[model samples]
Target: MPIDTTPNAAIQRSLRQCLSNAAFMLYQQGHVLETITIPFRGLDGSALRQLREASREWPACQQVLESSEAAVYNEHGRFVLTAMGRELLFDMFGQGAADCA
Candidate 1:
């Protein structure tokens, strides 16, 4: 499969903005990205909009995000991290992303 290697500053910023909503420490099964969605408060409007725009073209965004291994909301409506996402989260926060959880 072809990968979108082009730099997507918008998506990257959106991903970072989404991550800002919740605190972090480390990642377990679904720690880092999961925190963005809670029963009471889900992703903020801006973050959601950003994601929507980034994901407007599913295949395109998939290639782009997957290339960078970013955390994304899958078609199943679940937030999942790619390989880079895990590493990125760990780099940003150590141990577990449960500080605010």
Candidate 2:
């Protein structure tokens, strides 16, 4: 039998919200300064898979992260943001706040 891959609406929203928040936080803390894949942990299998798969498409969420003010190339295997990413993070956070509604 095949695994049911479809994620529920709540899970999908949660995933996007989590990723946005995580990226913003990482930017604020200066952790993400390069292109890196955040270790797939903590999230459920579906969420993780969604992120992985989404990266394959154009203009991905990771791309948003990379395009931020503090983005950089991932020499190490860790999700990072460059200087621009940090600035962009502030913007993203601000925008995300509005999404809370």
In model 1, pairs of residues that clash are: 25-96, 25-97, 26-95, 26-96, 26-97
State how far residue 48 of model 2 sits from its true place (Å).
Answer: 7.8
Number of clashes recorded per candidate: 5, 20
lDDT of 2 by residue, 10-101 (tens): 54444455446655543453434121233221233344354465444323554544543233444543344443444444455563332121
Which candidate number would show the highest lDDT if scored against the true structure? 1
Number of the predicted model whose TM-score against the real structure is largest: 1
Give per-residue CA lDDT, model 1, range 1-101, as digits (tens). Answer: 87565657667765554344323221321234544333232344455445555444433443454455564565555445544555555566663642222
TM-score of 1: 0.33
C-alpha-based local distance difference test score of model 2? 0.42
Please list the residue runs of candidate 2 whose C-alpha ends up more than 4 Å from where it truly belongs after superposition. Answer: 1-50, 53-59, 67-70, 94-101
Question: lDDT values of the candidates?
Answer: 0.46, 0.42
Off by over 4 Å in 1: 1-33, 36-67, 98-101
Candidate 2 least-lDDT 10 residues: 33-42
